[model samples]
Target: MDIKDKLAVDVLVVGSGIAGLKVSIELAKEGKSVLMSTKTQLCSGSSFYPLKASLGTQVTKNDEDKDLFLQDIEDVSHNMHDKDMAKIYIEEIKDRVDEFEEIGIQPYKLSDNRKACFANHGRTIYMLRDWNKIRENVTGILENYSNVTVMERSVVISLIKRNDKIIGAFLLDKNKELILIQCKAVVLASGGFGNIYKHNLNPNDVDGSGHILALEAGASLLNLEFIQFIPGFTTPKYKTLFGEHTLNYCEDFVDDSGNSILDEILPEGLSKEECLEVRSTHGPFTNSLVSKYFDIAMMKQIMKTRSEEGFELIYNKALYENESDFYTIYLNWLTERGINLLTDQVKIAPFAHASNGGVQVDHFGKTNVAGLYAVGELAGGIEGANRLGGNSTGACMVFGKRAAKDCLAYINENSFIEIDSQEELNKLNESMKHFSVHVDHSLTPNEVIDSIRDIMWFNGNVIRDEQNLLSAIEKIEELRKSFNISQFVDNVKDRKSAFKARNFIMLSKILLQAMLERKESRGAHYREDYPSEDERFNKRLFISLNDHELKLEFK
Candidate 1:
């Protein structure tokens, strides 16, 4: 086993999204040596993906409105949130927003000063002034820190733990060589596993490798079942996010068979107009509202047809006046992209947009493992079953800063443990050989990924039941058995894909297991067998790896 290089830093940030960059900037300001490892380039991941023209970061209008904001979060999450973490997020979000504004990520003020998101009340949604500018600003800020080392195209394959504490990590660099990064503290700000699904709005690099890294390093992941599924375009272009605001003007939806999609699937007593109107208020699919039926119908039609091309939406101009600034901006952005809501035929289906569950962390982003932390979409607990639209970015900012400050203090007192490269290299060699030794087929890594995505999008997707989940778990088991990692890891790119496939398969299995365990439908997680929320399952299900087996505990 040939190791490329060995380096040490005070802190290692395993992502380059808002959270990773935020924490890096904070640590660099304190003169700490921070290594920011990104799978791709800087500002890449769901945080900087240009699917939306701008992202809305939430803040309260006044101290009086804070209680209402908290209530909204609890209500939308259906009492499935961390009460303490939620309160802390609300208390610190305003400061995070102000901090970003100073760094040129200005927020666009609404005329009303407050607007509702996902059924929340008095929520002042500060749309980031411009998505591109925000990316440039963050990238520039991170670059200015001489103490920060930005290692692009470096994927963290595994964390190096000594005595149950994170002392270092093994990074697979762009050259297919291994680099050992020893650090006093590690921040797992890596984004969520949206790309594991067939259709997702996240970047290709947004796989759940970070979660697997943490799990292997003896960290627990919370609420692995609560994933946010939303509508995304399937035609005209793939991977484009379907704006929920368009639902307000949705007159009808027709499948590829030229039949009304909502005609049969709409629940009794819920009219098409009423359903679409209710669904238009939020971005992600939720069982807490009547709009859930809309997502259900879309998913059902897509699954039944098994079509890559989704259903078409008939737009009604009379349904909306487009008076709101949010609507105007979104509509104009669509027009600029050659998509006319009224004239164009828009095809959409339920796409895996984001994961509301991830590595379980406290308010300061500390995981169960010592010297390891998580933030952004990678960390869970602050936003429970379902996350509010803008709160994702807010969590990144608040928790990212908090984790950095806390970990900086840790680094000041603690010293890095001895990292043995020879032992780690021996393990890596054995794993690589084991990966190739068992394989009999020559399936490309892309094909393996496609197979996993198909299984997840079908069985473990929005609509789940006992039978389908079992089928999915079984299929994933078969796929893992058939796919050989080393048969395809001949080059740098191929090696990366192999790692992604392995992580995706493992994470998908865990997610399906979580979905199967949580029988009751709540927020983002829905089960056909158990159609209602259950009080017995209100607590978060934390999943961790122990003795090479997965363990689940409720807290």
Candidate 2:
């Protein structure tokens, strides 16, 4: 009941990644009091991974490049993206990139030769090699804005909704006390639920709580079925994502038994060079590629190993002479593990890299729920099925700013109305009372999280079938029965795990149910039962809660 940082602000941004940070800085610059809260450390989300810099976007030198870029996004989106949003994103984002460049945070072209940058697609992407420096630059500017109050370890427990509008939120401070956040608007940039999978690059804190909060507040999520599965090293030290270009050096994607998985699936027309170019452009394995069959084989192999290494990415060192930047990272990763990049074979598997769909938002990051906005990986529809390489970071900058500007406009026109604090507090208190009820003594959040990972990896991973997805749903439902939030609240030691577990469970059910609804393969959500993409199922799937019942629809 000890309220901390309970002061009012024009906007409350729930996250600390590029999206959240961008919103806070933008609004604060305009002299609006902005509260940016994170569940963990300031720079600990997917954006601030300690090991390596996440892939970023390329700069478009001219209008023609921009046009081609738009087309590329549409093509990769499987014609399912919001066409207007794509245009708005490309045109509006250029200015943001220019702003970054002016501020000394810049990106380098992925390849040396500009003309034949990519044979499969005629384009070059820019990646920020000095990610830490750029991160420091952004965070540094944010400090100059005294209007931005950043709170770490402050998680948004739930939204305070009244009369179909989001008026405030219940925040859990570091002291584990309830803080009623009364604000005009809330921008959710809480990142993705990659951690929901057994193998992922997401930190444990990045569990899908944002999605859960949106659902509880009457927001609908679109395209929840499209989770991008990219090949990354999952052993020795996990979640080391190979640069897409670096993976091009991989002459073959082989298995431990010396079987060339690529050989088994490589199309008759696609040469080894063409195969590399296509794979490099599209980071995740796609059925669109002639070599997509390799991904299906890779998924099977990874599952077959279950708890061990299975695939070897073979590369010819001679071919790597021209590759410098990306090759260095790949080489360093191997060298650190005492394996020679030139000699030792690397075993990699598909990782839940990014979520293509999230809380359905408009061009301005406005969700279905009024006064609630979502940005970054938390907002969906930007990337339809599989996202283009390095677009995640740039899109965050673009939409985060848009959300801030729109939220500010909304707040200026609409005054912050006072509400009954006692009523909201009582609602939360009632939910907390259920924590200790009907709890099994042996059941813990860790146990539940592991079960979720196992089920999702096996049934809801790179490839899926009806039987496994339905089984996953059943298993998740049964796990929910064994443990409840009251159990975690009663056990203070596992409070964090319990809350995070609830979010993961919510995300798992949403994803699986969406998968069940979509019978055909499209982009990343692949169904083995329906092996081919169907025009009938070309629409996006939407998930939302109606009277606590999960409802799914597609159009």
Tell me how many clashing residue pairs each candidate has.
0, 5
Measured against the true structure, the TM-scores of the candidates, in listed sequence, are 0.95, 0.91
TM-score of 1: 0.95
Q: Could you tell me how far off, in angstroms, the CA of residue 63 lies in candidate 2 after the best superposition?
A: 2.1
Per-residue alpha-carbon lDDT of model 2 for 237-279, expressed as tens digits? 4566655666566777666667787765565876766776666
> Per-model C-alpha lDDT, please?
0.82, 0.75
Candidate 2 positional error at 450, Å = 1.9
Candidate 1 lDDT over residue span 1-555, tens digit each: 357899999999988888887888888888999998998888779877878677778776689988888888887777667788888888988878877753447776665655556645756777764667777777677667778888898888878888878899888887877789899989998899988988888888899999999998888888889999888887766677788877777778887667887888777898989988888888788888888888888777767777768889888886347777667877777778887777777898888888888887888999989999999998888777888767888888888889988998889999978888999777665555534537657567788799999899888888999998999999887777777786666565677788788887778889988998897999999998999998998788889887556787777
Candidate 1 clashing pairs, residues 3+ apart or interchain = none
**After superposition on all CA atoms, what RMSD does each candidate show versus the true structure?**
1.9, 3.1
